[model samples]
Target: MMDQLLLALQGLRRSRVWLSIFRREQLPQTEADWLAMNRRNFFVHILPAKIHKGSTRLSYNWIWMGVISTWLFVILTITGLFLMFYFVPSVERAYDSIKEIMNSVTLGRFMRNMHRWAANLMVFAVFLHMMRVFWTGSYQKPREFNWVIGVLLFVVTVLFAFSGYIVPWDQLGYYAAKIASNIADGVPYIGPQVKQILLGGTDLQQPSLLRWYVIHVFFLPLVIVLLIGIHFWRIRKDDYSKPVEYERGRRD
Candidate 1:
C-alpha cells in the first residue's frame, strides 16, 4: 500500500504542467554542439532536460512558482498583521501612526518595509512568470484551464496593489483613489453608483479609507486566497508537458 501511494505521488510530480514546459535541466552533449553552441551543449535553460515518448514524462521541477507566490503572500500577511496593530486606518492618525511604528516598535520599520516590498515583488514576479508560461505555450490544451486561473490571479494582484495603495493615506494615495473611482464611473448604467459606493461619495475621503480597508483587509484578500488555493490544486490535476526540442545551450 505504501509503495502504491509513493508511486501515485511520483506520478503527480512528473505530470505537473510546471515541469514539462517551463523547467529545463542540464544534460550531457557532444563537444560538436549544433547551432553555433559548440562551447555550450548542455548547461541551463527554462525547460528541464527530459525525453518523452508522448507518455513517459520524466521528473520536473518541484519548486512550484504558485507555491512560492503563496509563500511571499504569507510573509506579507504576517508582516501586515503585525502592522495592523500599529495602524489606525484613519486620515488624521495614519501618518502619525506610521511615525510611532518606526520610533516605538522594535524592527517595525523593517517589518513594514518588508511587507510592502514583498507585496510588490510578488505581483511583479507573478506577472513575469505568467508571461514566460504564455510565450512558451505552456498553457496549451490540457493546461488551458489553469491558464484561466492565472488570469484570475492577475486581476487579484491588481486589486491587491490598488487597495494597498490607499492604506497609507498619503496625498498620492488620495489622488490615486480619485482617479480609480472616476474610472469606475465609466462602468455603464450602475457606474455612477459604484463610483459613489467605492469612493464613499463623489470624492476621496474618510469613507473611501474604510471602504478600501474592508476590501484590502477583508474582501479582495479573501478572493486572492480562494483563487490561489484553486490555482495550485488545479496545477496538480493538469497535464505536465515535456519539451520536444532544445532552444539554446546556456553557456553564459
Candidate 2:
C-alpha cells in the first residue's frame, strides 16, 4: 500500500496540469540552477537553499529564539484577528466588549488569553533573539546592517505591544496609556507635540482610544510586516546567518 501510494504521488507531482496550476514553475534541479532561479522568485528567495550543517546544531546556535519569535507572531496574529470580531474600540464600549467576549462568546476568553500571552511571549522572544545574536557575535561584519534592522524591529515590537495594551480601555489599560503618553511628553524638543499627537488632545479620551486602535490594528502591523520581509531577505543574503566561526576555522 505504501509503495502504491508513493507511485501515485510521484505521478501526481509530474502531472502537467498540476504542475502548471499548483507548482506554477519547476524548482531548479541543481544548486547553481536554484541560485539563479532564486533571484526572481520572491517566496523562494526569502530563505537560502542551504545552510551550513553547523548552523543547525543547538550547541552552535543555542536556542532558536528567532524561530520562536516568528511562531509567537503567527499565534498572536491569529488570536488577534479572532478577537477583533468581538472588540469595540470606543472608550465607552471597549471594556464592555471585552467583558461580553469573556462571559458570552464561546472560547472567547481562551482566545483572548492566548492573544495576550502570545503577544507578551513575542516581546520576550525578540529580546532573547537579540541577546543570542549579540552573544554569538552575529552582529559584526556583513550583518551590521541586519543588526540595526533587528534593533528597529525590537522597538516596533515594543510599540506594538504598548499600543495594543489600551484596546480594552479598562482601568489598567487606561492608566498604562496615560503613563506612556506622559513619557512621550518628556521628549526633548517635540515633547508636548508628541504627546498631543499620540493622545489626539490634551488628555486620553475617545480620540485617544480611537487613535490607539488604529495604530495597533492597522499602522503598526503593516509596518512590522514590511520590516519582517526585509529581515528575512537580509537573512537569506547573509547566507542563512551561519555563525561567523563557521567560515573561519571551525569546520570539522
Candidate 3:
C-alpha cells in the first residue's frame, strides 16, 4: 500500500498540470542551473539573476531604504483595507466613524494606527532612499529617467499623505484641506481653476471631502501602484546602479 501511494504521488508530481505550475520540479544544483532558474522563474523575473557585492553592503544602500518603503506601503494597504470597512466617508459621520473604529471595532484601533504609521514611515523611507540614490550618484547617465520617476513618486507619496489626512473630516483635517486649497490658490494663472476642481466648488464642504476621500482611497493608490511597477521594471532593465567607486572609475 505504501509503495502504491508513493508511486501515485510521484506520478502526480510528473503530471503536465504540475509541470506547468512548478516549471522546474527539482531544485537547481549548479550555478548555471540557478541562473537559468532565476531567468525562467516568473515570480523572481523582476530581480536580476546576480547582484553586485557592493549592492548588498550596508553602507552602499543605507539599510535598504527602498525595500523598507515598499514593505511599509504593503502594511498600509492591508491595514487601510481593514479600516475602510468601518470608515464612513460622509462628512457627518467621518470623525465619528474613526471614533467607532477606535472604540468599538475589533482590532480597529491597531489597524488604524498601523495604517497611519506605515503611511508616515513610507514617506520617510522613500525620501531617504531618494537621498541615498542622489548622494551615491545613482542618478547619472542611463539612470536620469529613473531619477525623474523617483522624484514624481516622492511627490505622489506626499499627496497620498495629504489626501489621507483630510479623510477624517475633523478640525485638523478641515484646516489641512483649507491650507492645501489655499496653496493651490497661489499657483498663478491656473491656481483658481485647480483649487475649484480639487474642492469641487469654492470652499471645503462635502464635495471637497468626498473628492479627497476618493483620491485617497482609490485614484492615488492606483496611480502609485502603476508607477511602482514601472519603477521596478526600469530598475531591472537598467540594472541596479553601481557603487560610487565603480561609477567614478567607469567615468574616469
Best by TM-score: 3
Weakest 10 consecutive residues, lDDT, candidate 3? 243-252
lDDT of 1 by residue, 1-252 (tens): 999998886666567563565332332365333322422323432122333453232223224455577788899889988998888889888867888887899999899889889889888878876875676566776677889989889888878887788888887777878888988999999999999999887777788888988888888878988987777656545534434242222111
Best model number under lDDT: 3
**lDDT-based ranking:** 3, 2, 1
Winner of 1 and 2 under lDDT: 2
Candidates' TM-scores? 0.70, 0.86, 0.92
Candidate 3 residue runs with Cα over 4 Å from true position: 1-9, 249-252
Q: Over the stretch 36-66, how does candidate 2's per-residue lDDT look in tens digits?
A: 7767667667667677787888865667888
Per-residue lDDT for 203 in model 2?
Answer: 89
lDDT of 2 at 178: 95
Look at candidate 1 and give me any clashing residue pairs. 20-241, 23-46, 23-47, 23-48, 24-46, 24-47, 24-48, 25-48, 25-49
Please give the RMSD to the true structure for each candidate, in Å: 13.0, 3.7, 2.1
Candidate 1: residue 26 Cα off by (Å): 37
TM-score of 1: 0.70
